[model samples]
Target: MGETDKHRRIMTALIEALIAFFKNIAGVYVSGNLMLYYEEGNPSACVSPDVFVIRGVGKNERRVYKLWEEVNAPDVVIEITSRSTRLEDLGNKRALYAELGVAEYFIYDPNQEYLKPPLQGYRLAQNDYAPIAPDAQGKFHSAILNLDLQIVNDNLRLFNPHTQKFLLTPLEAQEAVEQAETENARLRAELKKLREEK
Candidate 1:
């Protein structure tokens, strides 16, 4: 399934946002659209999840994730589903992740045209993936990452419950800082004007 530019951009943005959010956390690795080599010596047997998080793994760069080398599957795996890859993402990939012991599996439809709810999640229970219910706000909670996944205006968003804020992408964060600075400057000017009047 070939992805369009919009799909690519959304995937990259979400991955970058997660990376930025967890950059300072030790032993946490976040990546997107990278191959996970499950079976040794079988280069053909690999799955590249759209966004994945492996806890307890060193935050290092890798061309491929050899599960045998890492000694464990990713704690969380997210698939950015498209019209072309919808079936595979829902069936084959889900089965593979469950068989490989991925603790959590999530599917996010950026286009919001395929998946019924646009976001779905499952938690590994015993030997199968159990569906994780969404909250009243249509946010799926990831116990592994301890974050809430939601769709705001068709964009996939990750919310930090601890901070009660959405995890912003790099660009978004910069824009936020700039906005704060601009507001601060405006307030300072007003304060100076008030002092002059006094």
Candidate 2:
């Protein structure tokens, strides 16, 4: 089923932010809305997650995720769920991710369709999933990525705990650069005026 525009935007932003954050690190793969085939022959054992990250595997382009070939399942999975996919995201898909050894699974409801708090995280422990508790500010930490996940203004965002900074999307990063350029130009003009007055 096709997702809402907001859902698509959120997924794209997250994928871009994650790629920007982890691009320098080797063996970290970030992908979005790709078919994950767990079984070799049987096509039924497949699922397409909104965004996922797998570590320790060489960063390479793949048409579809093949668990057998990769030798590892996604360490983290984020599902941008809505009213239509809420049930699957919370139930069957959740269980499937756990069974596949996904270290952390997060589900976010951008539209506030039905999920309470709109963000939830779970950690795989002992082959079972345990609820990932939130911090004082209600941010869930992803141990796999060493980053914190939170909802800001009803949008799912990633935060770097170590840096105490939120990961900026590509658009946000570009805007930041432009703002810096504008500030530098203003400062240069002020300095020129001061030199002339001197």
The whole-model lDDT of each prediction reads 0.89, 0.93
TM-score for each model:
0.89, 0.91
lDDT of 2 by residue, 73-118 (tens): 9999999988889999999999999899999999998987689878
Q: Name the lDDT value of residue 125 in candidate 2.
A: 92
Which candidate ranks first by lDDT, i.e. highest? Answer: 2
What is the per-residue lDDT of model 1 for residues 1-198, given as tens digits with 9 covering 90 to 100?
467887887788888888988889999999978889999999999999988999888998999999889987889988889888999999999999999999999998887889988899999998789999999999999988989998888888899999999999767889999999999999999999999999
Clashing pairs in 1: none
lDDT of 2: 0.93
Lowest lDDT 10-residue stretch of candidate 2: 109-118
